[model samples]
Target: MGNLSRLLKESWTLVEEQQDKVAGYFYARMFLSNPELRDLFPTQMDVQRARLLGAIVTAVQTMEDPDRFEEYLQSLGRDHRKFHVEPQHYDLVGNALLEALRTFAGERWNIEYDQAWRDGYAVIAKKMMAGAAADTNPPYWNAEVLAHERRSRDIAVFTCRPFYPLDYRAGQYLSIEVPKYQPRLWRVYSMANAPRPDQTIDFHVRALGAGYVSGALVRRTRPGDLIRLAAPMGSMSPDHSSNRDVVCIAGGTGLAPVKAIVDELSRYNRTRWVHVFFGARDRDDLYDLADLNAMANKYPWLTVVPACSDDPGFDGEQGNISEVIARYGPWNDHDFFVSGSPAMVKATMRTLAGLQVPSIRIKYDAFTDG
Candidate 1:
């Protein structure tokens, strides 16, 4: 590694060691100096701090070579662009991080350390700007509920008419905000339906036992209910056309986003093979079974497999979805997408690794425990 790369590696290592403290000090400083940022964070400041610490630590630790690390940083920059995180925000974060280092490292902090950090910040900022420039912003979506169907006791399918023209690529998510809740809770829900410029956008929500907005969506939300939503954001879409073989592993309501991907891809002129492996607790919990069945019937290259862990009277593939997927065939031949609980995602990822599927081709979204 070059001198700059070596310095960065060392700095990142130090940051990792003091990750928790750095995260705490960083957020505290931001909230203190810039009161505006205080509201952007959750009510549980400590929890948010820890989560941020863990994410940064994971990102830094995974970065072995500087070039690869820079690529990861660029991706992060692009993701931040969707949230409108400006170049100034990087400086703010860096300042707070440096303050934490000064506090923790004490006498070791020097002019040379500051200069190195300044150089790093400049590099990061430039990369972030470049990423932002390359990003193709998805159309913003906002609407009022037009129709809703209770597919199951826990899951509800909602259709909403866009107040304005809406456009979204398959597999992207909509940030649904419930303003009624104090601090306003926002959760990303994948668009359950294909893009229709003239029609309603759909979201399939699963109830999580008084899960704030989820509970509201399930039992109380009605037609004509105004819902504020941000446009589609996420790279978990059908990006490669030539790569035909596709495998989708979905659990519970996690199938919502993947459904959009499959639905959109089915409409394409050139036929591509797709295997959807859907899982739920039981037959009663499964939604869109008929729709998937229809797709399989209509498209020669599409296949739907439903797996149930505790089938009881039911009879299908009786096991975890990942195990069932492995039993079917080699996972290496397809682009795999997994969406569910973090534990489920971890297990599915391990299964993919064992099957020799490349990590870059496998997309995942762990609905983070907030």
Candidate 2:
């Protein structure tokens, strides 16, 4: 690692454990320093605070991959346009971030760390600014809900059509805002199917504890409702260049992106095989099993395995999905796409690592809008 990456990482360790406090200090500093900028954020800062730390962690993690780092930051910049972020806002953010780190790091922080952060933040801001400037698309798209189906008490599947041409890969995720329920609060969900010419997109949402956006989306959203969609961001799409068989591990609503990716694969795949392991806590939670089975039936190259962890009566695979995957594998040669709750994703990734699957062969979608 370069000196700058090393310094930034080592310094971050000091405050990483106290993430909440560091994030608290960050927003406190920003709002105190520039109270006017507070208008750009939602009234509920909990999700925003988590996203702040998540973004930093992502930036730090991707620093080793220059191409990925630049692409992700640029996409983030374009996505942040909906927040009305401007060139001056980046300056304010940098100042607040540095102050937050310095406050949390206490005596452990020093000149070298400070310089490394300044230089790193400068690069990050520059790339984000460039992305924002280069983007010609609108800050957000006007989407009209065309279909809404309740699959369970907490889960709903909804489809929307953007008024504009919403260009996105099948496996990317987009943030949605329902102005009626929560105007400023936005939550992200994966595209549930491949891109189609009709410009329709699907999302599966499971309401979390006290999740305003998710609750509204599941219980209240209906056909003909108007919602806002932000630009799609993520790189966990199909890597067609390799043409290797792929395995998709999905739990609950995480099935959305995996379904989208499989849809994309269906378009051109002839030689490669695809295996989908859909898991939920119980049979009731396997809400999309029928649909996935239908897709598998239609596609000759596809295989669907539904597993339930807590439902003893489930006749198919019936353990943690990762454990089930291990029984089916020796999958070191296959590309891996994983999506689920953070805990589920972590456990699955750990299992894959234990099997000696190359880290480069695995791609996981990790985000919790709830």
Candidate 3:
């Protein structure tokens, strides 16, 4: 397994920088050899290309741990049902992937690397197949946008309800397909609220970069707009059994999952304290502070602290959230859940590390933005 892991990781290092070329080659080969499979994907190949490469990256990441790797592959397989992926398609993709890697890996590629990836992909396909077969849930659900509110120039809050109950944990993230976008194009968002009897989901979207789905969701979606939601996947739920208190940090729309976990904690918590640090660049970006205050007012065990890095007029914690956290007592002993843009999460993690927070005590959704 060690040699296999080394060979896999080494192969990735050789091609990751040239991923665009690799992805282009893989897809071109597939469409050229099996044109029928082209109908299974979206008209715009941009999102599909990134997703395929991302899936391979994820698979390689988990290769070190057999159980974790298998579980991830199975979950991925279960999720891929939404794409109508078949067993035969897996073989098709595997061959294209090998060809792509070999072409880009150049002289560094050897029989050992080829055989390792082949064996690894076989296990990956088998596990994914088993997972898809075991799932009884629909590949996706038709949802109606119940409400849409533009909180800022680039941000929107949407309330949507699936036609059927969408069973998911409080903090899990789900991929949503919008009718306004290309057919079958999907983007992931954290469900901002805990499950209600009504089963409505709240999504907070902010247009970042050239975020295609975020732009569509923020600017174009309207009430009564129909959407599709794929299965939920994440593991950021709170541990109620732990005696330690909890500290949740969030920035921008990353507040979704942290808020859901806190909302979930409200149902089971008795004595544990929960401290929430919500931060943004300016006052307008801290859009959920009022709502968080309302939650804090209702729950005696929860505390919400608002921070603004660029708002000089702000009377609250007027610094980066990571800096504000330092003023509070060292929460190194508390269970930590952090979410936000990848950059914000990275800075916060570095701060937590400096505060002597044990790695095991920290948790965050590393791939929410990916």
Candidate 4:
């Protein structure tokens, strides 16, 4: 490992136990040093602190692979532009980060550790600035909600039309900022349809406990509501060039991107067999079954299977989605896509691996939140 990486990993192990404290200290120091910068962030600091710490940990873990680490940093920088982050802000953040580390390290702090952190932060800042400079598109697109349907008590599907053309492939996600919910607070949602000629996008949102943005999106937002969308990101799109059959496993709202991919396939009249296994807690949770069934009826190449984990009286596939998938497969030769809560995705991936599916044949977005 590189010296900087080693130093960061060592220091991180010590500070991780007090992550909340370190993040609070960092933000407090930053706001104190530059009070003018406080307005850039949301009023709620709890989620913000967790996000900041999580990003740092992810960057540190990716340090061993320079290419991936650089790409990750650049993407992060480009995404931050939507929040009106500027070059000068990077300097302020870097300084605050170093100070927090020093405060936490106390007796463990030394010149070598300080220099290493400085060096690492320099790379991150430089790449992020470069990424910002290279972007030609608008920082964010303003979209108006055209329609909203309450699919269930907890889930809502929204169709929005952006003022400008929002170009994105199937299975990509966009970060949306709803001003009415909490101005400047952004949350990621998968685009639930393939590219439409009218530049209309669809999002499926499920409100979980204390999900401030999601609750507002599901229950408060209505037609004519304006929302800001960041650039489309994620690498979970289908490999169009591959002729192999596909197996998709989706749990809950994880079905969004899978449906998008299926829609795209239908548009192209793809001949390769496509099987989708949709899982939910019970029959009532299968909010999109009608849509899926309609798609299956129209597309000869697509098949939809609904599974329930908790309903004993349900007639369809009964079990966890991963377990049900394992029952149907010798999925060794098929391309696999799994999306769901983190635990579901992880378990599905393990199941696929046990079936001897090649790692390259399995594609998923690991960054999605439940």
Highest-lDDT candidate: 2
Cα lDDT for residue 320, candidate 3 = 84
TM-score of 3: 0.95
Clashing pairs in 2: none
Overall lDDT per candidate, in order of appearance? 0.71, 0.90, 0.86, 0.86
Tens digits of per-residue lDDT for model 1, 1-370: 2554556556656556777777778788877887876655556454446654454444444445566556556655655543456667777776776687667666666666666666765666676567666767532345788998899877888888877766667887766754444233455688887888567788888877536667777777888777767655665787655564888899888888789888888778355678899988899777878888998898888899998888867678888887888898766567788887777788889988888888988888777422
Off by over 4 Å in 1: 1-24, 39-90, 100-141, 182-184, 209-211
* Candidate 3 lDDT, 1-370, residue by residue in tens: 7787788888789898999989999999989999998988777786578678778778878888887787778778878889899889999999999999999999988998899899878877888899899889999889999999999778888999999899988778888888667477788899998999998999888887666777889888899999999988777878767989999999888898999999899988988899999999998998777889999999999999999999999889988887888789678679999988777888899999889999888888754442
On TM-score, the stronger of 1 and 3 is 3
Model 2 over residues 1-370: C-alpha lDDT tens digits?
4778888899999998998998998999999999999998888887778786678678877888899999999998989999989999999999999999999899999999999989988988898889999999999999999999999778999999999998999789988888998888888899999999999999999998989899999999999999999989999998889878899999889999999999999899998899999999998889999999999899989999999999999899989998899999769689999999898899999999999999999999966636
Off by over 4 Å in 3: 367-370
Better of 3 and 4 by lDDT: 3
Clash count of each predicted structure: 0, 0, 0, 0
Clashing pairs in 4: none
C-alpha RMSD values across all candidates: 4.4, 1.2, 1.7, 2.0
**Local lDDT at 221 for model 4:** 94
Error of 1 at 166 (Å): 3.4
lDDT for model 4: 0.86
Worst 10 residues of 3 by lDDT: 361-370
What's the CA error at residue 86 for candidate 3, in Å?
Answer: 0.6
How does each model score on TM-score?
A: 0.77, 0.97, 0.95, 0.93
Between prediction 2 and prediction 3, the one with superior lDDT is 2
